[model samples]
Target: MPAQPFTALAIGEAIRRGELDPVALTRQCLTRATDSDAVFISLTEQRALVEAEACAQRQRSGTLRGPLDGVPLAWKDLFDIAGTATTAGGKVLGKTPAERDAEAVRHTAGAGMVCIGKTNLTEIAYSGLGLNPHYGTPHHTPPPTSSEHEHESRNENEPRAPGGSSSGSAVAVAQGIVPAAIGTDTAGSLRVPAAFNGLVSYRPSQARHSRLGVTPLADSLDTIGVIASTLEDCLAIDDTMRGSAPLVRAAAVPEQSVIVLDAGCLDDPRVSRAVGDNLEACASRLKDAGFHIVRRRVASVADTLEAITRHGWLGAAEAYTEYRALLEGPDAEAMDPRVRKRLEAARQMPPDSVVSLYRLRQALKTRLREELAGATLLTPTVAHVAPLLAPLEADPEHFSEVNLATLRLSMVASLLDSPAVALPSGRDDDRQHTSLQLSGPCGEDEALLRVALGASSALTA
Candidate 1:
């Protein structure tokens, strides 16, 4: 039989049919996880094998847990795994291991998913660019060296950014080391990385998943999300995490308008023509798929940006509140400078500013919902494809500029409390990936996921 695609649903089905042994699958994933660039910060090989052995036994007894049973996955290092340090991709955290698995981890484990290891991330899940000074950034594992041929714009040797705070999680899946992984999307951490790596990522409604035992970034803005190769896989992981019933057939695509925002940022010089073209292609596909595509300018989007500019981001304020002690403590010197700088800046903002921004954000969310009522909003997940890692790391100014620009579109969804999914559109001129994001009204995640599944197929096709 042909090898199944590297996805939870595929692997688990094989395990259930007794065609694949769970212990053997666990070993394979562990081997690949170690070989897949710098994706994993730590590997739970022994425990994973033990769990897989049990899963295999259960399969023999006709006690299969679910679609994810016996599947291997990596967790972003920020999640607390029992007896492991929750590093948050920073050096400052002490060596004390967590007492138990994070709530989400426990949920998945209970559903029989094997935990392969802890994946790396941007320090404290702070940046979208995924460059981490402490835990080295995980890049797309460069294609093997070959003397066969070479192209001018392409060097098979140079590594590209994997999209961040959830950098390692994306790399793990993209490299075929795992079927899926968990990530936090405070401001596009999950979506940006998924876009850069050419994978499926779903940012559920903020209130959908429990945040307990997960390291906080921006408590209010932060959301639990999954990165996988397909929306079905993401839905499976999400369903397991939420302890929901088996996923039913996705609802048929709704015949509603999709608002495509074309503003300065969308047309900004930083956005490559190829990226813009991909966005257009995605819009064209959606229109061809029987959905009305409306080109419109939303003033509330400007309001969202203005609020961020006038008052520091709500995430920045909230993250500062959560990590201020560590930032100001004696171990402060050990923190990543890039992350430290941002947190320090947020610390300087007045408490009243955060309060005012929160109010403004709420009002803007209301305005955006009203403006986009009965329709979904679409945008390029990021301005450009995965950037070369070296140049950005060499220049902090450029890093900061690109980082903010990359977050420009996805951050809007976060600000408005919308549930969004970043679906791969296609590859660009450099053969790097780009994605189109579909963000719907809050609490409408299920419906949006269904629409996205259809749109993703059409856009990619």
Candidate 2:
């Protein structure tokens, strides 16, 4: 029989039509995981196969749940999976298992998606660069040339940063180990990796999904997100996560004014010429599609960075709050030094200053909404393509520098509490991927997805 398709929707459709068996599909993905097992902290092999068998039975009974029914996906290790240890990419979590699935995980499973495993992430999901000194970091593995189970003799590409804190989840989809995976975005965890690995990542408005079972980075800024190969897949999987189809408007005229920040935002020295060209080409294509492109200095972007500098980063402050006892206890010695340092910095923040920062953040959000108007904003998801892994592993200082730079643009959307999608922007000189991000007003996720759907063809053209 011919090899089954790789995307979730396609695979689900095949299963629904009896062209593919869910059990067989699950086995194929499990086999793929074997070669890149470093991507996962734990594989729910027995559980997944059992789930797949039931899904296969459901398909035969004409009761497949939905487009995601029987489809296998990986989750970032931060999410609670009943009976599995929720590591949050840290060594200090020990062996305690979660009694119930994360609300996000429950929602996805309820929609009939099978959980193959929990993918690795940056330690505590703290960094944009997907380095995990505790759990092994997952790198970008090239796709199989033939079947989903094809194993190559040798990998010619040098290992590069996977883009974290959703590193493994992004790699799983990018390498075709799975069709799609769930990731979390606090600042730029989802979007940065999507940019580095050539996948589409969606960051919903902060309040769109419940955060009950996922490990917290910053309660106020954290949001559940999905990384997939296409916008449509993201929409489908996002629907499953949200427990209903998004409130997407039909036949809504595409917004014509595409807002762009000044060249300074896109001209970072880390950005490659190819990435710059690809971004320009996407803008030009959108302009040809009748969208009027406008360029300006978005003062809000600057204001966000200033706020972080003045009041200390909310992510750091909140993360410190969540992990204070742990960091202060003896187990703190086991924590990733990089993450420990960040939380320590935030620990020093004055209680009153953190409170004041929240007020400033509220004001900034309102000011940005008015300044941006209805024009959707566009920017490169990261300043550079994924960096070589060796140097980053060897130097903590270098890792911190690159990690912060990788997050510069995507963090803007997070600060504004806006919905954003990062779309692949072709390849850079090293053949590594880069991405362009489309950001819309706060709480307008579906609207942004619709705009992205309309503009996707041009962006990918």
lDDT of 1 by residue, 1-461 (tens): 12234678888889989999889888888888777666888898888998999999899999988888898989999899998898899887738999999888998889889999999998889999888877688886443323445343554347888888899999888877888898999989999999998888999989899988998888889999899989889888888888774586554464654555555456667677877888887787778877778777777877787788787678888898899898879988888888888889887898898889878878888887788776777777888888889988998888888888888778888987889999887776556787878888778887677777777666656
Candidate 2 similarity to native, TM-score: 0.92
lDDT of all predictions? 0.82, 0.81
lDDT of 2 by residue, 115-155 (tens): 99999998889999888888788886533344545443332
Top TM-score hit: 1
TM-score of each: 0.94, 0.92
Q: In candidate 1, where is summed lDDT lowest over 10 consecutive residues?
A: 143-152
lDDT for residue 232 in candidate 1, whole number 0-100: 84
Model 2 residue 32 distance off true place after TM-score fit, in angstroms: 1.4
Candidate 1 displacement at residue 307 in angstroms: 2.2
After superposition, which runs of candidate 1 have C-alpha atoms over 4 Å from their true positions?
1-5, 141-157, 254-265
